[model samples]
Target: MSMRLARPGTSDKAETSPLAVRGLTVSYGGDPVVFSVDMTVAPGQMTAIVGPNGAGKSTLLKACLGIVKPLAGRITAWGKPVARQSSRIAYVPQRTSIDWDFPVTVIDVVLMGMYRDLGLLRRVRPQHREAAMACLDRVGMRDFADRQIGQLSGGQQQRVFLARALAQQADLFLLDEPFAGVDAATESAIIAVLKALRDEGRTIVAVHHDLSTVEAYFDRVFLINRRRIAEGPVSTAFTTDTLHEAYGGRLSDGFTARRA
Candidate 1:
């Protein structure tokens, strides 16, 4: 894929750090979920956060996106605090989080990403529509632009959400389980888009659960279980030791342990 130009105001001299998290900790219902964690996402890199079920991987992503407030520590994007630069980040939640019964067409859902830039009183201009369509095309979902979101298959729905994130045109992209329940074809398509984004100097971080795909799909991997166990290039960080520490006997035991 051809590299896209960097967003305006991002200086050429600026170090290409897309996200920085320091001492991040989160709690749910007053119970600690994600412990103090430090992580950084560099431009043009695909970073995957992996762990066992209830390992706080999803919570970590949410904390970075500011959807779930962190009890302690800081998160910055493009050198600015996340709370101050929310527009610079786009997030695609787990597919199950969306209400499939909601009355909305594919186009409508994709257009939601543009609401921040368009504001409440303003209408979606032709430029906005064109951009949204282009995003859908990039994800190979242009043909489904008018279809009802609920009627589409799981993979199609994922593509639509990804297209919506593309339409947001943010500097950083956070995705939760983009591969879950997706068919091989859809998974390939999604990975291609992610690779394109990384090649274009965008930072893409995903909460990924499939250990088997880590080495194949990501440039960097973070193994976490409440706290970080290891983080670095997949080859260096995704070791048996780290897996054992992060997932305990579960990862080594088999699917049952991993799922437990």
Candidate 2:
């Protein structure tokens, strides 16, 4: 199948952009990673960041959240700096980053999402626990709420983290490789929840690796290989050429021949 651009949904949605980045440049030890990239995320859509490994897709998300200091440029959510609107954004990190042996229960981890609203030194009320349990149910993990995190399988652990993100009820969700190392059941469950959230007008930006699923899973795409290659609707931007550029010599022919 040939690659083409999606209809121009991304062009006329400036008013709906909850997340906007301009002239963004990030570096580590004075070595540049992401170049000057300016992209606007339309509200209520799933935006996937796709590129070769080590191309800094995750770094771009971190820069948006002010977690990693950028040497240049700026990011804004809802026309305000992310630092000021942190409460409205939720992030689901890759499962590998989590410490399963930390002695936290499934529900306990989900409750962490509410601590921001609970405030410093404020006690977690019983209602907070109730809300967490509700989120666990949404992810099909309610039955595992009291279980030790380490005891769960890989997919179960992934679901637990997703439950935590859902409990946040944030307008914007930035997910890092939610599909990585997960079973098909877990992937199906997570995508179902994400689609439901999008139908509710919540914005989701995910760092995605599977090329074949891009068009099927996400509405928009951002292709990066240290520099932005394309940004727009999945059909329009996820072209063979863009993938080639982003992946460099790393893209497999099997994937290129397969259409999204």
Candidate 3:
């Protein structure tokens, strides 16, 4: 059996890609972070946003989610404006960006993903708890459901956030470096979950830093460096030349450096 997203609005029948950004530009303070980038992300596939440091990969994801106000261009989902379709999207941010000392338990963090559906005055039901626990089990963290987030390891914490995204129950998932600092086993679990979502026709857009695992994980690659390099299948777009150009002189990872 496959999972399906619950949509509340539509301007067009659900097609291949619901996430599209044209002429996107994001700036902070005075400087531009993402410069006029256009992207069309297709559903039912895992797309990896690969770039070097300061390349604004995270900013691009945020802009599409309407978290950062775009300085230019428009973002759309299902051929309508993003605001109308935001409820169908889920986002998982980097673990390092969060405060580890927060007093929330693992289940508490996962349940936050249901807030959009729960709204301000609603209360959690037994079904929601069951769903959240199922998500935790998918990421191999069900046993630690009651553990405080601050007490978990880096990999465990990352898995918890991913479980939170699953609880969002959205069609499109935007993940920021789910592989960073995770153990190999945790990485495998995350990839398996992402693939399961993709198999169910969900779209996954992730910011990935590991060059070695890119080919194994993503179905398509969007290589960027504040602008655009190339976007295609892993076999073509992730070539030596394109990677070198996008990374420039900053290829520090052992596998990536060897390729260079």
1-260 per-residue lDDT for model 3 (tens digits): 02111221233332335787777899997788898787778677889999998899999998988889988987888777888887898899888899989888999899999998788988889988899999999999999999999999888999999999999889999999999998988888899999999999899999999888898999999888888677768887787778777887786556565766
Give the poorly placed runs of model 1, Cα more than 4 Å off: 1-16, 253-260
Top-lDDT structure, candidate number? 2
Candidate of highest TM-score: 2
TM-score to true structure, per model:
0.89, 0.92, 0.90
> For candidate 2, lDDT tens digit of each residue in 1-260?
14323323333343457788877999987668898877789799999999888888999998998889998986888877788888899999889987899998998899988878786888888989899999999989989988999999999999999889988889999999999999999999999999999999999999999888888899999988777888889887888888887787788888887753
Task: Give the per-residue lDDT digits (tens) of candidate 1, residues 1-260.
Answer: 02211222233223346787778899987678988787767577899999989989999999887888889987777677788888888899999998987889998888999989888889888988889999999989999988888899999999999999998888789999999999999999999999989898888999997887887889999778888788778887777667777877776566435534
What are the clash counts of all predictions, listed in order?
0, 4, 0
Q: TM-score for candidate 2, please give it.
A: 0.92
Model 1: pairs clashing at backbone N, Cα or C within 3 Å = none
Report the CA-based lDDT of candidate 1 relative to the real structure: 0.84
lDDT against the true structure, each candidate: 0.84, 0.86, 0.85
Q: Rank the candidates by TM-score, best first.
A: 2, 3, 1
* Model 1: per-residue Cα lDDT at residue 164: 91
